[model samples]
Target: MSAKTATARPDTSKPPKKGSLHHVVQVHYLFTLPILIMYLVFFIVPMFMGIFYSFTDWSGLSSQFNFVGFDNYGKIFQDDDFINALLFNLKYTVALVIGTLVVSLILALLMNQKIPFRTGFRSIFFFPAVLSGITVGLIWNELFLKVVPVFGQTLGIDILSKSMLGNATTAFWAVLIVNLWQGCATPTVLLIAGLQSVPKDLYEAATIDGANAWQRFKAITVPFLLPIINIVIITTTKAGLTIFDYIKALTDGGPNKATRAVGLLIYNDAMQGGKFSYAVAESMILFILVAIVSFFTIKGTSNKEAGDA
Candidate 1:
């Protein structure tokens, strides 16, 4: 064949088929469509409806309501129950964050060590996480009411001689203990995973450089675990602020409403008291509060993470 006759054909032939990006994206949307619809119907719609009603005088039983402007917002600040519940939630949330952080981190450290039956120990520690909150609350309620008192009496310990739930002063701590016991389980697991992820060579080098346990932890372990700790903080804060199930099953917001959380208060106002609009307003305030706290927490943690990096 003459070279001139073999002029190369332009590679206008179709390129090898890979895959359609559009098809993948469409498949993902298809998979998520049902969940998106459910979220819209269950959460987003109700949330907007609640916001709308918060500005109105809807009794929730009647179809008719009149817009009251900022009246509900004004009333929220002046309401003693709302104020008390807010304070209690603040206190509870702080304790939960601190307690969960300390307890879980400690347990994670311990569990990370080489020991006999480490897996079994981890399983034992993690058992609480799998239990239903309501079930655990109910079980703990009985213990507080029944078993704890016997131990208290036998030991002559005045604090536990009666159900901690029965005393306003002790009720907060009682709730905290149960929550910490249950709440720490997941965080501990997370921290253990985080601990395992820390490079052994880094620890060895730190030790070689004469860095003690605390120094190595501060310089290495904490930096690595910051993200997980941030998660723990956010979750525990939300749980503390929106506490209802535990309070409901354990204390019922009793002992003169000492443990009446905003969640419980909102429920009472909306369901039993029939202040539906009022409750909606309270809930909106709560939403704002949670948003504010979460915003600050995330911001602070991001700054720390960035600084560490």
Candidate 2:
């Protein structure tokens, strides 16, 4: 009877081997497959292709080209259009980073207070950020071309009489202003988030210690806000460096190309002028410039914060 009761049981001993395709398909692959596929098809492939093409004189159309190494890079230094665009980009970046930070920080501080209709005000301020870059550019284009001219005619003001985009001297400023208006909204929101995340106990403690408002801000607020500030600066700088959509939509690198940014220059070179290889090379240079600027900015701000602490 005891022998007859003994029975075989099913084995539940081990897991599937990770190296098996079946295991991969059944476990982690589904979750990460889409992102990995997209990354490979879009970013990784394009980057390598761009780098390879940069050394060649390949037209955007055909594969036939000479691989003249370093020639494109050397020629860039002598290219006046590229050089001017680079310089203009630098100036635009500086103005954007400084102006956005100043305006956004102020707005963020003001918005942080327990004021009436603060939520409504935030919506109003952030409204522009949701608009299409091209659409915003077109709207501002009308303001500059039509509305401003009408005001100028009524007031007998000379500078506002013409389309600001048509004037080389003022075109750069007009583009910068439009970008500043659109750009500041995002940074303000980010700074508002940063301000909200700050612990209130530190402020309370400082207040109890006879700290004035300015002193408390200087001592506690700035230190805490430094990380967000640096993040804003980096992102803003990158935007300025790679500025394209607004400039393209608004100016199209016109008014004698005075408002031509590096982005426009590259786009014109690749798409418009059919100098794809040269454009790729120029893009590489811009990449280096962006990296250097970001590194220095982050290093400087972080060091300053550490010293203050």
Candidate closest to the true structure, highest lDDT:
1
> Local error of candidate 1 at 234, Å?
0.4
| Model 1 error, position 252 (Å) | 0.2
Best by TM-score: 1
Q: Which stretches of candidate 1 lie above 4 Å from their native place?
A: 1-33, 301-309
Tens digit per residue, CA lDDT, model 2, 116-208: 999998998998898888888888988998798888788998877787789987788788888878888988998898788778998999899
Against the unseen true structure, what C-alpha lDDT does each candidate score? 0.91, 0.86
Provide the RMSD of all predictions against the true structure, rounded to 1 decimal.
6.7, 7.5
- Alpha-carbon deviation at 261 in model 2, angstroms: 0.6
lDDT of 1 by residue, 1-309 (tens): 666434433343644333344444568789999999999999999999999999999888887999999999999999999999999999999999999999999999998999889999999999999998899889999999889999999999999999999999899999999998899999999999989989899999999999999999999999999988998999899999999988998999988999999999999998875589999999999999899989988987887777443
TM-scores for every candidate against the unseen true structure: 0.88, 0.83
